[model samples]
Target chain A: MSTKITNKEQVEAFLESYDTFLFDCDGVLWSGTHLLPHVVETIELLRSRGKRLIFVTNNSTKSRKAYTGKFAKFGITVSENEIFGSAYSSAVYLSKVLNFPKDKKVLVVGEKGIEEELESVGINYIGGTDPAYNVEATDASLASLARDESIGAVLCGLDLHLNYYKISKALLQIQDPNCHFLATNIDSTFPSAGRLLPGAGTIVGTLITSSGRTPVALGKPSDEMMNCVKEAYHLDPSKTCMVGDRLNTDMKFGEKGGLGTFMVLTGVDKEETILGTNPLVTPKFYADRLGLLYELLQNN
Target chain B: MSTKITNKEQVEAFLESYDTFLFDCDGVLWSGTHLLPHVVETIELLRSRGKRLIFVTNNSTKSRKAYTGKFAKFGITVSENEIFGSAYSSAVYLSKVLNFPKDKKVLVVGEKGIEEELESVGINYIGGTDPAYNVEATDASLASLARDESIGAVLCGLDLHLNYYKISKALLQIQDPNCHFLATNIDSTFPSAGRLLPGAGTIVGTLITSSGRTPVALGKPSDEMMNCVKEAYHLDPSKTCMVGDRLNTDMKFGEKGGLGTFMVLTGVDKEETILGTNPLVTPKFYADRLGLLYELLQNN
Candidate 1:
């Protein structure tokens, strides 16, 4: 059974249980631009107590550096190293882990974030933010549709400019079993302006079905992203606590990584979801919101 | 065992077995623009013998009327009623089988074919071929994204102008469990311009993943389409033969509908795929090509 933290002692004990905190950004720190109450103060309290913080977000629309700006906008002083957006993690996984070929380029089905992260890692890429691919496909236009032999991998992420032309070209390339099929994250939907929009998984889903192939998703709940973080920081999973709102991604990620899990009821999932029968991933501790930890400690 | 038709006796015996022949278009009639050699002659031979012909295609890009124009282009006289494209079948299924509410509209993630078929049946629709939905999605633009309550069903088919905006809106609408999620057909890839391009299944796949809902597919291999054809044509399954290229859609469709299955080796699957152990579906007869029916009769 998951314990619901209410008293000041419980909050203090929860804080003391882990030295490092991995937070899922969207629903935890802020929900569609409006920062949750006591978010900044709570992070500040965690930092003041000499705890390490890493922002883990499945939203591949923004790179690590771009997310730093988003953090600054909320009055949070988060460095580039602290932010692990799927885009950055994917780039790292491709270059560092997979040892992507030097002569080959990665075909992107995403926005500037994936492109930016790929460039930052000194990896050549195409498709994302490419004006040539922005046009609507016609039978005549697709007449010359062929695989680009230079493309070694097809990396799919959330793309606002997603079109048939990009995916059609992607399908041709990935059909070669030798070519790697990668997804930044498979999050079905992401909250946008208080509304949920189709996420990267939706974009990847098209290719998955058409190609009769599955892609290697390097995001939450996948040990790839966890390893990317663990290797970068050399942190002990047993001493790390994953604090997030979603059970499938955040809580499951923590549970799979052997990290302590703290569920906050301020995002996609709620309290009953954790306590209900057949819960997706039950957290060790649950609270009304992330701010409750700060509130309990400050009050008593 | 599948009988490989060769001589006059096998050809004549095959012809005498079935009065009505269901032919899968794309691979059977023509492969992309250039019609396969002796296709017209083969159809002429079937017509000469007083055999009924029904052109059934999973390619939802064209309506029955549009397909007639294509048939005319190839010197084949095929009326709209004799054509059963997935788009038209889906439209018929929605109106007749489901008895779709007259007050509601279908949100389409396809091309003019679906819109034309829906309009033919006097079913109101939005999204398909709509210039408004053709634009690329943006965070600012998707902020107001909400479900159109009037949309009772989301019918997905092959859409060349597929964009994130169309699917994002589709996900929001289908999120409502009351809304019917439908796919015209789930053919993975269609041979286009000597290349395989992502088909209708790819477009529907995005919503399937994001919405976490399975759509009611109305196409080949589906009993729904078979029932629609059976009710309309009043054909005897025992006297009908499904002649097509693909095993999964064509052979399985015929087998399930209690029709004789005849495999032609001009489309997606080759001879080895069918004769191979653990074949997806087995056909009652196999031929090198559809034109062999005419060739064997003419030469012998």
Candidate 2:
């Protein structure tokens, strides 16, 4: 059974229980280009209440800097330091957690966000958004294909310009026994402009199937993402609450991290999903929407 | 235990047992650009014995016509009717078995081979090497992306020109409840110029993960390919022998189709793979290489 946080008392109690709040942006705060009602007010209220806010998103398509710009578009103020997207998390995991070698470069099979994050972490990378790799591959190209010996890792994410040349290069790079394979996230699909589009998982899944190797995925629901957050913030798990709309990524991530979870039915999951048998992951608290928290807090 | 046919008597006995022979081209007949010695002699011998020869390949990159041209280059003449490549098989499966509606067309995410095969069957298709769909997709393009309502199926195969636009279009088309999702083969990698390259399965696997739907795969190790061959040549499974280099695709295909399987140690699988305990699928007979049959026949 999940507690429904509806009234002002419940909202105040919930707020008092957690000093740190981790939010999944896509579903809870907004959906696609439309911002959910009262999100700006609720977020501001939480900020005023001294909540340490962290926007943790599985969208690896955008860097922290880009996310800050997107937040501004939503009429919300957020610093780059407050954002932890899968691209940033993956870079953190590689540079900080894995202690990726300085001499070697990562062969990226993703978009510019990944490259930007890797650059922020001072990690040398090749192939992401490279015009040479974006072209159509032929027999001659495939035959003469060569890789830089410095490529020690293959990092992949949601790549819009995913081409055979890139996949082939990544596949070849990962063939070396010493090469590490990493993925930003394995999100199968994300809501986009009123429809579900293929996500990073599709790209990673293709590589996994082609290369017959699974990558170390750094994103929501994975302990690595949680670990990245924990190491960066140095926060106590018990004092943190993960608020999101999805069960598999957000709620499961919270549960795995041993943090309190709050499910907002503004995203992929529904109320029945929370109450249903064999639920993927049960949240500690459930709400009709994130705006409900705003109404509760305002009334108080 | 797999019986290893070594001598003239053993080879003669093996040939006499099966009326039809299905050969996997790459490793058995040739590897890369070089034709394996004695393959032409062996194939000629089989034809002289009144045996039906069917070249069954999981390589969807080429149509039957293209395969025939390749065979000609190897000094071995094979008609398009004798070739059952994944591209041809998938086309046959959709047009002949599925009896796809004439009013509707297939949205292809593959190479020119698939387009040729579909055209040969008089099936209307969009995409597949079309310059419009091969371009990189942008936010503007994705927003303006439209689907042809007449697209009732999404067919995929090995596509070097795979891009976001094609994947997105296929993803959207398959969203229709009535649209059929079809794949030429799910072979993860295929031998190419002495190295393994990502195959059609990689492309199809991406769509499968993204769409959250599995396609009806029509290639080696699946009965659909066998059905295609049977329909084309009137093959009786019991009297047919599948000879190939790979255990998983070729041998497994033969075993699943209830045909006698002959393992040729010239391609992906090694001798230990067939002799090892807990083998995936045991072939009915084994040989050092397909050329050994030529030697045995010549000696006889």
Candidates' chain A TM-scores: 0.98, 0.98
Residue runs of model 2 more than 4 Å from their true location after superposition = none
Q: Give me the runs in candidate 1 sitting further than 4 Å from their true place.
A: none
Question: If candidate 1 were superposed on the true structure by all CA atoms, what would the RMSD be?
Answer: 1.4
**Which 10 consecutive residues of model 2 chain A have the lowest summed lDDT?**
A291-300
Per residue, candidate 1 scores C-alpha lDDT tens digits across A1-300 of: 898999999988998899999999888999888999998999999999999999998888888998899999988899999998889899999999999998999999999999999999999998999998887797766876788899999999998898888899999999999999999999888888767778888899889988999898989978899999898899899999999998999999999999999999999898879978999888999888898888888883
lDDT computed for candidate 1:
0.90
TM-score of chain A as modeled in candidate 1: 0.98
What is the per-residue lDDT of model 1 for residues B159-198, given as tens digits with 9 covering 90 to 100? Answer: 9998888888999999899999999988778888778888
**Candidate 2, DockQ to 2 decimals?**
0.85
